[model samples]
Structure formats: structure tokens, C-alpha cells
Target: TNTTKELTYSEAMYLCGYLNGAKKENRDLTITEREIRRRRSAVLKRVQRIGIDTTDWGAVNAFFLDVRIAGKKFRELDGEELLLLIPKLESILKKKEDGGY
Candidate 1:
């Protein structure tokens, strides 16, 4: 069976802090998570081209965790962290385009 739980406003606010560089509980996935997922995919596609197995979540999470300053898992990164991470990811892509990856 499939079920879902809705978020409370307080939880949304907490996600605000959590995403904006403050520590807080990650109650659920939100729009920012989707954006993070997209960014991760872009990186991993390049990673795969460099011959790393994208199927291994361990390596994937490690790469993302290293990209941002926080979050044990990539999914836990919030908006502020995302802002920091985007440039880094783009830079990596740019360098790789020049055959550095």
C-alpha cells in the first residue's frame, strides 16, 4: 500500500533553517530536494563518463557530501548549502569539459 504524510508549517520553516545553513531535523523531501537530485544527476553523469559506477550510492553520496559542507547524505542539504554547492558542481563540469575529470 502507498501512503503519504503532509508537512506542517513548522516543519516547512524548519526546512527553511536546515536548507539555509542552520541545523534542524529533515522532516521530509521538498522542492529543494528535487533540485539537489537534478544537480546530483548532472555530476554523476560526468562521473560515469570518467568510468565510475553510478549505481554505487556510497560513492555518489560521498561525492555530494564532500561538495557541500554539511549533511551526512546529499538529500539533507538545504537551500543555503545548495547555493554553495551549485558553483562547485558547475566548476567541476567546466574543468571536466577541458578533460580534467
Candidate 2:
């Protein structure tokens, strides 16, 4: 049997914050911003529950969390815009968690 749990919006939010902080605070962090986003998306895609579309929602949540955590505010971006940001966020999150960053 397979068991799965969807990430809470807050969990995703925490991850996004973690990713952003890791990048900003860890200059010695070797991972590229591009790679970080990619890894983050991979994690989100792994989610089996919650959100209408895990991949899309993950990306949007990531971008919003990053922007908000960074203390930079901007106009609302459409889903497509957020989708475009997933890979970047994924890579960052992965590297940081893996200790590559």
C-alpha cells in the first residue's frame, strides 16, 4: 500500500522561507540560484495531495514565499508567471537541504 500526505500551505511556506534565507545568508553556498529552484520544484511535484495541481501550486507558493520572505513586494503574477519560477526555487531548496549550498 502507498500512503501519501499533501504538504500544508504553511509547510510549503516554511520551505520557501528556508530556501530564500539559505541563499541570502550563505554566500559560501555553492549552489546556483537556478539549481535551487529546480530542486524545490522536484520536492513539490513529489507531493501527492493538496492543491488543485501540486506542481503548479508548489511553484506559486514558492515564488510568493520567496518574495514575501525577502521583504520585496510586487504586483500579483499569474499562475503562468509563478510556474516559470519553480525550477529556480527547486534547485535552491534542494541544494540547501542537501548541504551543497
Q: How many residue pairs clash (N, CA or C atoms closer than 3 angstroms) in each of the candidate models, in the order given?
A: 2, 17
Q: What's model 2's lDDT at 52?
A: 25
For model 1, the stretches where C-alpha displacement exceeds 4 angstroms are 1-54, 67-71
**Which residue pairs of candidate 1 clash?**
19-78, 19-79
User: Over the stretch 1-101, how does candidate 2's per-residue lDDT look in tens digits?
Assistant: 13224667776666676867854446445444445555445434532222225546555445455653222221344334446545555566577668785
Best by TM-score: 1
lDDT of 1 by residue, 1-101 (tens): 13224667787777678778665333345555776777666655665664556788787677656634345566675566655665665666677889896
Query: What lDDT is obtained when candidate 2 is compared to the true structure?
Result: 0.48
Best by lDDT: 1
lDDT of 1 at 8: 72
lDDT of 1 at 39: 66
* Model 2 poorest 10 in a row by lDDT: 68-77
* TM-score for candidate 1, residues paired by index: 0.42
On the 0 to 100 scale, the lDDT of residue 54 in model 1 is 79
